[model samples]
Every structure is written in C-alpha cells, then in structure tokens.
Target: QGVVDPLGGINTLWPLFGIGNQMLASMALILGTVVLFKMKKQRYAWVTILPTVWLFITSMTAGWQKIFHEKPSIGFLAQANKFRKGLDEGVIIAPAKSVADMQTIVFSNQINAALCAFFMLVAVTMLISAFFVIRRALRSDLPTTHESVVTLRNKEVRHV
Candidate 1:
C-alpha cells in the first residue's frame, strides 16, 4: 500500500476551507441581525449587521480570487490550467512525480475551485434570505419570540 501525504495539496485546500468557515460565521451574524429585527430592536441590529456585511464581503472576495485569479498559487482554476497545459505537452512539471501526478493535480484543483464556488453560492443565498426576513420584520408588527420578564415582589420572597 502507498503512503498518503498528509499535507499534499494543502495550498489549494486552505483557501477553500477559510471561505467555508467565514461563510458559516457570516450566516450566524445574519441570523443574529434577523433576531434583533424580530425583537423590534432594529437600532441594535447594526452590531451584528456590520460584522455580517464585512464577513460576507471579505469571504466572497476571497472565494472569487480562489476561483478566478491568474496566479497559480492564488487560483485553483489557474493552477488546474497550468497542470493541464503541462499534461498536454507530455511534460512532468515540478511537484508532480509523473504524468499521472500531473493529471491528478489538475483534477484536484478543479474540484477545489468548484467547492469555493459552492461556498460563495450558499453565502449569497443566506444573505438574500436574511434580507427578506429583516425587511418583513421591520414592515410588520411581528410578535417577539422572547419570553416576557417577570419581577418578583418582596412579599413573595421568604427569609432563609
């Protein structure tokens, strides 16, 4: 059996992983903003709204770069194209042990690029859904989902 390299292709994987993680954080912040709106506290919603917007923008930008940038190190598609060119010329490029390794690298990069695109799509969908929910909450007098606060009377308290 051949031993697998634990760190192989990590350069391509790291950006995709980072984007996925940030997308999740962005989703949570969007949910927080929506909850604040539902509670009729639109003013305080900016606390979460700012982070949500920042995360969304940054994550999307990163994902876009990973998918489309020209540099092989920065873009998965670019890396894939580079390897494919090498494969077409029947040359084994650096970091690729053989023609088969070059083929695997090309396919791996393509998969990574697709994954990055998928993450971006999910993030956009979530942001759009949150926008509608927040708009509805602001325009309508929706009942709050939180429990009412109850104050205890001094007479109801027993001395230990």
Candidate 2:
C-alpha cells in the first residue's frame, strides 16, 4: 500500500460536501416555505416544500451510507487497497492494478439505458417542479404590495 497523501484524502470528501450542500438546501427550502406561507401564498410554499422534503431525505440517506458503506467504491481509504485483490487470478485480462482504477472499472458501464432513463426521469420531475413555482410566482392574484397603509392624517399612503 502506498503512503496516504493529502490529495487522496481530499478526493474522498465528496460525500461530505454533498451532505453539507443538501443540508443547506434543506434549510433554504424550509425558510422559503415559511416565508411564502406567512406571506399568504400557499402555492409558492408548496413548491418550496417539495424540494425541501427531497433534500432532507437525500441528506439523511447520504449520512447513513457514509457511516455504513466504507468499501472502496463507497469511500473507505483503509480498505481500498484490497480492492484489486478480489480480482480472480489471471485468466486472460490484467486485473485492476489499484483501487482508483478498479473503481473506474466498476462504474465505467454505469451510463447505460437504465441509468439514462433514471436521469431523464429526475430531469423531468425537476422541470415540472420549476414550472409550478414559476407559474405561481407569475400569478397576478398574488399580493404585490410589501407594505400597505390606510387612513393617514387627512391623507392616505398605500403601497401598490
């Protein structure tokens, strides 16, 4: 096994970064939900809740996988060195020489029809969700005035 390096450690941090991003997204979604609902716009609030709920779920799942699945394909640097050992003794092809190489081989075929379909499904769902939010935001019935005042001293101040 080679000596551990700083660059390798950084390479394993993508899951942590994903977890942080999802958490921030969840927080933003919650804030948006509250602000929109308090502003008396239920449609917009509902839009915010959809992604918030998804973000929370995905973050929790990532957290679980981080703690449980520490395999080379998942992110355990200590065990990664053994990944190439699992390859059968030479039949005709050379075994994956290293963990990173093996991981690439494992996932190299991932972009198949099923994966493409799943990606398309997710994209379509996102597009539909965005359309709803945009439509609600553009509705003329929604209140436009941030502040409204009525019955001032012999005058009226109204935000329109």
Candidate 3:
C-alpha cells in the first residue's frame, strides 16, 4: 500500500480559489444589502448585511494570512522567498529536486501571492463602493433603480 498525502497536490491552488470564492460571495452580499437599501427596505437589509460583514472579515483575514504568514506551507510570499533564497545560495531543497524546480516553485508562489493581493484589492473596492451607495440610499439621495409597480385594470387586461 502507498502512503497518501492528503494535501500533496493542489494545496496551494485551493487556498487561492477559496479566497477568491469567498470574496465574490462577500461582494454579492454587499450588493444585495445595497439593493435592499435602495428599495427603501432598510429594516430587511440585515439579512444580507450580516453575512456580508462576516464573509468580508473572514476572507480578508485569510488572504492576509496567506500573504504574510511566516510559514512556507501557509503563506505564498514566504514560500516564494524561501525558495528564492535557496536558489541564491545554490542549495537544492528536498521538495525541489533541481534548480529549475526551485525556480518554478518560486515563480508559482509569487504568482499566487499576486493573485491573492488582487483579490483583496477588488473586494475592498467593492466594499467601499457599496458603503457609499448604502449611505446615499439612507439619505434618500440615491434614486431607486427598481422598476415601479404598474397595476393593470380590468379594462387594460386582455386575454392572450
């Protein structure tokens, strides 16, 4: 029987994917809250607002940890730096059997770090925009974009 490493493959990619997914979810919730406010249903906005706040906090914290944590297995930038230093010193690491492998690992980790940073930036931007929209909605300064209700009278109703 062969030993199976549960996180042997795709471990690095999974965290990035998860962070992106959560960020998108957070944005959707924020948008939902803004729409509720725009419709002048401020009391019902908490349904989306609460989840938005929670997801934002969780996702941002995860992203930050992935980018800045000291552990190579946990942080993309840290892993990249570790491999880079190994390459600079002409040392071949266990996970990296060759110099080319080390270079590739370093590049991949850097790309992952950049992607995490970009996701965080987009999430922050969306949150800021939603904040302003909700504020304007509360002040009645923003017009509702939802279509107005049109009542159909008996005379206006026609059989298809």
Candidate 4:
C-alpha cells in the first residue's frame, strides 16, 4: 500500500454492508412494533431507550477510529505492511495507499450508520407516541354497540 489510494475496506465489504443494512432496517420495523404494542408506557419507553444507548456506543466506537486515525485491526495492519513490502519488492501489484483516504471512507460509513440509528430512534419514538394516543382514544367512554359495529364496503360485499 502507498500513500495515495484509500478505501481498501470499502472495496472489500460494500456488498456485505448493503445486505446488512437491509436486514437491520427490517429488524427495526419489527422491533419498533413490538415496543409499540406494549400496554404499559414504561415498557414501550424502556424498549426504545436501551437500544438508543447501544447505538450511541456502537457509533462512537466505529466513528472514534476515523476521528483518531487508527488502523482497522492489528491483523489488518500487519497484513497491509506485508502487502506493501511485497509491492515494493515487485512481487505484488497493489494500488497506492493514503491514511487520509481510509479515514474519509470510514467517516462516510460512520455518518451513514449514525443516520440509520437516528431514523430507528425516531421511528420507535413515533410508535410509542402513536400507541399512547390510540390507547387513550380507545379508553374514552362510548356506546359499546356503536364501537363494535363493522361496516362493509361494496367491494367487500361483491367478494363475499
């Protein structure tokens, strides 16, 4: 590796990132509903609150490396050094390398991750609030017969 090419990690794991992102988004949708359906407000609050803290920690750890100009892992660093030495000896063909390029790539990914966390937090909060609102509306005194009635549309009658 040289001091000119960056984004080695991105080049390797971009596909995996896309797949993982899609899975996480789906999980959030399901988990958000689980929190929303809790009859107790405290349960709903706790469900959303804990994950927010977890995300904060994850974001910080992932983002901190970029902020501090740290390498990915000890093994990765060792391998990169070996690769660079091989390239210098004309035994391997590798692109130029730059720490700045790596940091920029990490920063972009961290930003995307933070945004995803923010969206999940927002969705969970909205679900909690919506549940409370609906629960309150349901609790209001009303005629039981009127509340129990189910109206069918013309399309539904045709299907029947």
TM-score leader: 1
lDDT of 3 by residue, 1-160 (tens): 0012122347667788899999999999988888888878789888998888899999999999999999998998898898899999999876777887787778777877898999999999999998898888888855475745555874454321
What local distance difference test score does each model get?
0.81, 0.50, 0.82, 0.44
Q: Score every model by TM-score.
A: 0.85, 0.42, 0.84, 0.34
Compared with the true structure, what per-residue lDDT tens digits does model 1 show for residues 62-83? 8898899999978889988998
User: Pairs clashing in candidate 3?
Assistant: none
Tell me the lDDT of candidate 4: 0.44
lDDT of 2 at 21: 64
lDDT of 3 at 154: 42
Clashing residue pair totals per candidate (backbone < 3 A): 0, 0, 0, 4
In model 3, which regions exceed 4 Å deviation?
1-9, 141-143, 147-160
Report model 4's TM-score to 2 decimal places: 0.34
For each candidate, C-alpha RMSD in Å? 5.5, 12.4, 6.0, 9.8
Would you give me the overall lDDT of model 3? 0.82
Candidates ranked, most accurate by lDDT first: 3, 1, 2, 4
The 10-residue segment of model 3 with minimum total lDDT is 1-10
Candidate 2: tens digits of C-alpha lDDT, residues 89-124: 322222445545555433332212133334334534
Candidate with the greatest lDDT versus the true structure:
3
